[model samples]
Each structure stands twice: as structure tokens, then as C-alpha cells.
Target: MNTTTAATEANVTVATIRDWARRGIIAATKAAGRWVIDTASLAHRIAIGAMKRPAKPARKATFSVETMLAIGGSRWQKNGMDRVYINNWANFLPLEIDQYKTGNISWAAWEGQEIANRQALLLLGSIDKVWFDSADGELHGRFGSGESRIATRQEVWETVVAGIRTAIAAL
Candidate 1:
């Protein structure tokens, strides 16, 4: 079969297959201006590798609720809000989050800030579109500018406290 099909069957890159063939680990032939590999030879090499090095035993992933709590607490301290891992089952969330931030802070710090943003959203009694930033770096609550708004000073404290509790429970 052609290199592309062979690579697909082998679960490796075309470059990897090329490297293996160049190393004389597998045989290949030219077909239609492209390299075609012998499926049987490729299978034998894979079987040999399986017998020699073998595949490492797969392990189950464990999610620690403590880690979630720690993340929430850390965010609360930094952002003056609450945050939770909406869905980071594989722990790749930090990398995913870095795509949105200034890329200077640690993943833990960034995660906390994100949680706090969500907390701040609810606390300020603002709609989903509103964002709040503290002027003095102390007090933070939302204030919507447009006609489509749901922010007010009177209910801000209670809503934020309730939102924090809800966010914590979501973890």
C-alpha cells in the first residue's frame, strides 16, 4: 500500500514511516511516483517491536476533587472571585487557558483568575456579557453600560456570595 495508507494503518506519520524504511527496518517500492510499503513487512516490524519493547500498560486517569478546591481557593485569593474547571478531565486545561491570557502568569494563577472572572460576573449582578474590573484593585463588581444590563450596587454583594457558593459546588 502507498505510504499514506501504510502510515494510517501503522498509526504513525509519513515521516516516521520514511525514516523506518530508510533505516532498512521496512521495505518499500515506488508506485505512481509515490512510495508504497509492503503491509506484511510493516506488520512484522510492528509485531517485533511489540514483542521486544512492547506497549506500556495504559493507566486510568484520576481526578482529584482536592485539586479543584485548591484551584478555586487560589483564584478567590487572586481575582477576588471564584473559578472552576468547567471540563479539564485530562489536565490539559492550563494549556487551553494560556491561549486566552497574557502568557506571563503560571497556569495555576491564570486558572484562578478565570474562576474569579466568572465569580465577579455573578457577584456584580451583571448579565453574561458584562465584565468588571476593580478601580482601586480592591472592590470589584460589574456595571453594565448598555440598555441590556442587569447590574446594580444594592444586590451585588448577595448575588456574588451566592454565585461563589454555586461555583464552589460546581467543582
Candidate 2:
């Protein structure tokens, strides 16, 4: 099987597969913008002690936000709530969504956006509607009446932690 496909099937990231290659735990070669791995070697590594298994991060309502950011951005984020919210949302999107070259695409290239938005709704939560009432104060009143089927904030944090553990184990 193809190395990249095998790694993904095994729930291991490409970087981790590469590290295993460099460490002589897996045989791989870059070909056609993809890495091919020897299935036999991978199994051997898993059987022996050369390849360490990944451990899931401890669950917590409030894990280090910086650690979550580091899992992808390589830098800890200490910005305010808005920035953090955006980052969290971005992390949940597909890599293609994050990689969109908005500058080159025309306005008509948004069917993809609709698909992504719908998928995000399922993965995160649906935004039924938001209301802003300016009757009380300058801030007014806000409400989030979305479907409650998606992941909670704590669940999202735990998912991030799990992802980080998977990534670090590969590295």
C-alpha cells in the first residue's frame, strides 16, 4: 500500500511516518509528491519497540490553549477572545478551506464554501440564528439558538489535545 495512504489509514500523520523513515523504522521514498512506505517494515516497527505508540492527552475542560495552538501554528497564541475563536474555527475546517487562495478565485467559486459551511455546521454546530437586541444597554442582548448536536467547547478542546498527541508521537 502507498505510504501516505497507509499512514492515514493507521491514523498516523505523514510527518510521523517520515520520522519513522528517518529513524530506520519504516522504509519510504518520496515519489510523485507522495511518500511510499514499506508495509512490512511498518509492521515490524510496530511489533518491536522501535516505534512508540501514541498516547491520548488527558481530558480537561480547560487544557492549555497555547498547547492547542502549538499543535498546528508552531507558535502560542495569546490574543483576545475573538482571535482565539477564529483560530479554533479555522482549525476545524478542512485544509483546503484554510488553503483557499481568495485573491485569485472569483465570486462564483463559493459552492465549495457552501459545502464546507454545511460540514462545519455538522462538525461544530449549526447556527440557526443570532439576534441582537438594543433595548437594554449599548452592548444589547445576544443569543445563540443553534442545534445542540455538535461538539461542546470541552469536547473540542479534548479533540485538539488528541490531535496534538497524535502529531507529537509522529514527530
Give the number of the best model, judged by lDDT.
1
Q: Write the per-residue lDDT of candidate 2 for residues 1-171, one digit (tens) a residue.
A: 554455555566544565676676688775433446888777776566434655555443322334334444332224422121213332322211222365321111011222333444444443221111122211111222333234444444444445445543444
Query: How many clashes (backbone atoms < 3 Å, residues ≥3 apart in a chain or on different chains) does model 2 have?
Result: 0
| Candidate 2 segments whose C-alpha is farther than 4 A from its true place | 49-63, 69-171
TM-score of 2: 0.37
lDDT score of residue 134 within candidate 2: 24
Where does candidate 1 stray beyond 4 Å? Answer: 58-171
Cα deviation at 1, candidate 2, in Å, is 2.1
Model 1's alpha-carbon lDDT is: 0.41
RMSD of each: 17.5, 10.8
lDDT of 2: 0.40
